[model samples]
Target: MQWRGRRQSSNIEDRRGSGGGFSGGRRGGGLRIPVKAGGGGIVTMLIVGAIAWFVFGINPLTLFGGDMGGQGSYQTSETGRAGGGVDSTPGETDNFVATVLADTETVWSTRFQEAGETYPEPTLVLFNDRVESACGIAGSATGPFYCPGDRKLYIDLTFFDQLESQLGAPGDFAQAYVVAHEVGHHIQNITGVLGKLNSARQSLPQDQANALSVRVELQADCYAGIWAHDTRAAGYVEPGDIDEALNAAFQIGDDTLQRRGQGTVVPDSFTHGTSAQRQEWFKRGYQSGNFGECDTLQGQL
Candidate 1:
């Protein structure tokens, strides 16, 4: 991973202590509460959290109560933001993420330039327990996600700890792979893949929709591999880094998660492909480093 002493991004919004609550406000100089669709308010979040936690055995605290640091309300103020009362703090982990983000920007910007297109870098939001996004309010339990609505990446660094202890995928490169996967989603959004998929999904049945989502997710994995390829070319990768990332891809696969969460595997319900498929597509992207080779939508899986 060797990410130390690298450049950190300034586009980070550090809200590690904003707590969990929803209110209406503008994004001022500090933490700004984002307004978007799909927010049903606190009561709705509670109901949704209970169902997800009790029934699915997933942690619901990330949905309702974010890290128990502050009050749970959906509003942001200059003083409300944590992390030294600024948008971003220069912590070690923060530096690591910012560096990874910068690397992605460099790789994609050059690639996009080669294609005669512009690459709009995405903002990465760092939160502790909960954060409001254009997609919806999310808790740390939601994991890292890319919201096309806002063109931002949301992540709670504690997820890295969970990745190590709970998911058993440890290492800096693995963490970078997570960031790259979300950035891959951003690439998809920019490339019109997401738009076309959204339009197509509107008329699709549930099973078919899930299948399309699997392709989308797998393609994101492949895109992550592309980032890895460029990263290695830039001399940032070390020995065992690729293996760490591959193991991470395996650990977070829908099949692995389902088998661990429940007792069975339902391929029809799979949305992110199996471990083998994930690893395969990632390897494909890393080996070829060609965007066209990463198309899982038109090609057979």
Candidate 2:
């Protein structure tokens, strides 16, 4: 968490305070889709929508065409102030985000070089309210996501506050994990996992598709752990940093979120794994720091 005065990523695209500005609503906590009805058909549709979003890392707003369930709206918190968003000035929360991004770049670039491959750095788009990507339009309520269509990561920083306040996961490292996880999705995209997934999902049943999505998300969590492993090796991670990330992985588990939201657990609707599975995959990556170990699709999930 000692990120002050470090390298900040120049790939940031700031669109805050501009036109198409934030529509202003708090999305429901956790990664699960917000289904309005608990009926079997509604649950199945929600699962399909959520899995489709995960397949390409599409923003949920774009998945539902704006109101996701149309219930439990909250205000989006700003890092600096309400009217003014993050400034380019150093030592700010936005700069901290850039620093963490730079850290991932350093780690991944080195690893890719070791493997005789060049790392294609991804641009991170910082927007408020809504933003348009090659995939489609995304609202802040969709949370942070990486769109494979454009090879970019999009975030509304206010989701960080929601991660802390609503999801009960807070800390600098937790925020770093969020960014790293999205970048993990980008890694999958570059490595062709997403491409194969896209083609395969089309021929699979809804249940099988959801299961595959879980593997995809769990692999991303493992990749995040791999990044954390590199961070530790670089002497950047401090005590309690791993705990913050682990808690984050736990808080956003599909089962945990579903139980909290509707008092029931629909295993078929789980795109992301359970809390134990998430922590386990992350720990596996952190312990080995091996790309082979993070292969959730090929190996046991």
Candidate 3:
């Protein structure tokens, strides 16, 4: 992905070194402990964290034990934000992300305008290690996510490293695909998919809820493909760009994660769909370039 030297998104927020931990207060070191759901439920939280870490791809450190001193208080380790501080490498990554985000904004804005609606550009918060969000306190292990509550997308650039080293999906376009996927979630949130998923989650069994999550995730993948379609048409994507993204799509699919973690496949436990499904839907979106084509829930799964 030839992303350098491109225009970045104005909605990007550089909170990479802002207040995260409590008491001492510093960047990338830890977070100011986030307010948990309730008092006296620490064990439940631990269990929740363990479950979520596996199911939702969340890291465990974001669960608890941050210093949480008042905001704007503290020191920085010599490393400086777990290596994010003053690092130009991530800055380059952010530049690429910004360009892709800008592209998404353009495409979605046009799409929305065609529908007689206004597209509100969402902010992208790039961080390292740990961060706090309206959805809850989150760490880098949570990967990239879109929070509908605050209408923002949170991502740890280090996930790019994981995508290369851990997930074996390496490339700038692959990283952009990740960003597009989250923005896809943001699109879903605005389009009422989140409410439907929430209602399903509330009423369904665990397995069924996981199934719905798979649909939601696959739809986002498709939406990302739709974004890619526009970017490609605009001459931003190269010949092998789609393949790089598909490799990424395969690497992080729920089926891949499940097989890696649990040694077997459980269809009911799949939250992000199978690798084939992800690749297929992404291809569908890229081919159709239609938002209406991303309905993962309409047909047989």
Candidate 4:
């Protein structure tokens, strides 16, 4: 990924050193999922963290005290760090993030214009340890997430360290995939797919809801691939960049995560698709670069 010297997004809200204290609880019913975790790798933490939010409608931090049995600890802000105050200056990592976001804005805006609609660009919030969102208060343990209520994507750049070390998916493009995937969710939100899924989930059984989640997540992966397609067309992608993203998609697949964490694969509990399925959907989008081709809902998977 050749992101240097590119335009950086002005939509970023830097709250890195600001303490994200708990206040009023979750304000609205919206879809929220953590993208990274500590013990048991990304998938294991996602399962636990998802239960904390999706099932119980509470903050994941409330349940982090239990043994997660993973290699790394959840990234958190220390007292000294939290009190140090926000750093307005953009660092190397921050610049990379902003550049990626700007690229997504350009791609999605073009896609929407083609359909005779306007794209509402989402704000990306950079936080440390914990952050308050309209959906709820989330600790870094919950990883990067998109809150539909506020239409913002929240991330702790430190999660990239865990992505490379704990999850074993490294590279600038892999990091870019994380941002693109969340923006994919933002795309779903604006297109009304997210709202419909949330409504349908309310009446469905657990297994069925999980299935819906898998489809939704896979579609986001496909959307990320679409962004990759546009980015490549714009002459930003270098050789091996696509492979790095594919590897990331594989690393976080529900089946792959379950196998690593529990030594078992339970299809019914899969909120994200299998590794093959994820890669397939992503390839579909990357190959076609069409939103119509990326539909995972009614199309054969």
Model 4's TM-score against the true structure: 0.78
Error of 3 at 78 (Å): 30
Better of 2 and 3 by TM-score: 2
- Candidate 2 lDDT over 1-301, as tens digits, reads 6666677777676666533322222222222223232334655344333422332133323222343332111111233212222333332567777888899899889999999999999988777656666666655655777777778787767666656655667777888888889899888889988777776776789899778878988999999999999988888776777888898888888777777667789999877788899999999999999989998998422
Poorest lDDT segment (10 consecutive residues) of candidate 2: 71-80
| Candidate 4 per-residue C-alpha lDDT over 1-301 given as tens digits, one digit per residue, 9 for 90 to 100 | 7776788888887665533311211222222334444557566666444322221011112222222222111111122121121122446677778889999999999989999999999998887756777765666655677777778887767677666665667777888888898898889888888777777776789898778778888898899999999999999987777888898788777777677666888999877688898899888889899998878888322
TM-score against native, each model: 0.77, 0.78, 0.77, 0.78
lDDT of 3 by residue, 1-301 (tens): 5455666678876566544212211224334333233233564344223323332222112112232221110011123221121223424555567778988999899999999999989988776556776656665545676666677787766566656655667666777787788888788878877766665566668888777777877898899999999998887776567888798778767667667655777777666778899899999999999888988989423
lDDT value, residue 119 of candidate 4: 96
In model 4, which regions exceed 4 Å deviation? 18-90, 299-301
- Once fitted onto the true fold, the runs of candidate 1 whose alpha carbons sit more than 4 angstroms away are 18-90, 299-301
Q: Is candidate 1 or candidate 3 better by lDDT?
A: 1
276 in model 2: Cα distance from truth in Å? 0.9
Which lDDT value does model 4 have at 90? 40
What's every prediction's RMSD, in angstroms? Answer: 9.9, 8.5, 9.2, 9.2
Residue range with the least summed lDDT across 10 consecutive positions in model 3: 68-77
The whole-model C-alpha lDDT of candidate 1 against the native structure comes to 0.67
